[model samples]
Target: MVDSGVSAAYPIIKNYIESLGRSLNDLENILLTHSHPDHIGCAAKLKEKSGCQIWAHSPERRMIEETDLQFSVRPVPGFHTLVGGSVSIDQELFNNQEIYLEENLMMRVMHTPGHSAGSVSFRLSKDDALFTGDAILLPGEMPIYEQVDEYLLSLRKIDEVGAKILLSAWDEPKSGAEIPSILRASKNYIEQIDSAINTTCQNGKSDNPIDFCKQVLERLKLPVPLANPLLVKTFQAHLD
Candidate 1:
């Protein structure tokens, strides 16, 4: 499994895996995209049932290996409810690293940070498919990244890959010409959020990040549910 969904998705994922004619015990690896609770929620359970060796970047290792520390510091909303638990990473991944699943089948790790310090995307060398996990969110989605600059740079890196198949965690799989279009659109959405931030605080952004996030969301006419501490942190990235 590339990235496990929420804790509630465990049985669903397992059933799907079984439906494919493979038992959970047959699995051997769980490659993480980042350390976000939602992204790594069912990881622990998956690893436990399958004896899979989990792989994650060094920047995210601490969080992925220590759920208590993550909750104590970040304290994301519904953190405890969402995350199944933490599990140790068997191998540390890095930029340009190639992982062979089997003979003639390979996955190239792309260190596409920004969504998080350790965020990564994987490219299936044999099939030319890219599995981008929350690295390229669409316009209607809530913006949640650590650094706007890094996110933009990562987007450019993803574009350079020129993969024929673009499989994002958020959006439907896109292909061929649609890949670049979606990437460019994702970049533009970030730019739009940047502009909204500026417009919301035309008098200069407030020192209070939470308030600033609310103002920007109001300016964008985004849903109230989107206003949260993570979104606040995302807005604060521009200030930094």
Candidate 2:
């Protein structure tokens, strides 16, 4: 199977794979997008048992070489940790490189960073299916922002690729029709940051970025979670 092995994202994937009744030897070769545990967990253990070759970005080779406590936890909610294990990659992918799978299936590597420095997305030129690791999320009315600049660049790159289908790590299949809309929303969200900074400057209350984001959330019609401040803090990170 062309997977790093499921560690944190969902063990159900591994359960499902095992449930298929395929002999361990039947599944071979794992292509990883990055070193994230959810994507690369179970690689070493699976490899030891199944003898599958794990291929990932050259930088992620270290992931399999050792395991860390940091890689053991889900960075955010809607994510989970995989069992402990190290992964070793047999191959490393580079940008703008193409790997032909079958006559109809080939993946063109595109480095779409920001989520993680080495994060990447793969495009299927023929089928037009793009695997966006975590670069984009399904439309949530308001666009979530990363570090602003990097996130914008990644969005522009997605437009440049012009895939018919956008597959994200979090969302379901999306049509090209939603691309421009989400991009616009993402831009609008960025603009709100400017407004927040400017308002803070004018009011001399620049110290409270959280309150500024609360105002922005209301303007954008986003649900402000009362249980935790993490959601608010995440938005504040983009402020100037």
Q: Write the per-residue lDDT of candidate 2 for residues 1-240, one digit (tens) a residue.
A: 445546543355456776998656765776666666556666776677678777667654665455564344224343235644666667788888898777767888888765555667888877698888667644443344345577768878988788888877666677768866765665565666556545655666435655656665554466644312444544555653
lDDT of each: 0.89, 0.63
Q: lDDT tens digits, residues 6-100, model 1? A: 89899999999999999999889889999988889999999988899999989999999999999886779899889998898999999899999
**Residue 160 displacement in candidate 1 (angstroms):** 0.8
Q: Over 4 Å off in model 1, which ranges? A: none
Q: Which stretches of candidate 2 lie over 4 Å from their true place?
A: 1-11, 18-24, 59-80, 138-146, 190-240
Name the lDDT of candidate 2: 0.63
| Residues forming the 10-long window of minimal summed lDDT in candidate 1 | 203-212
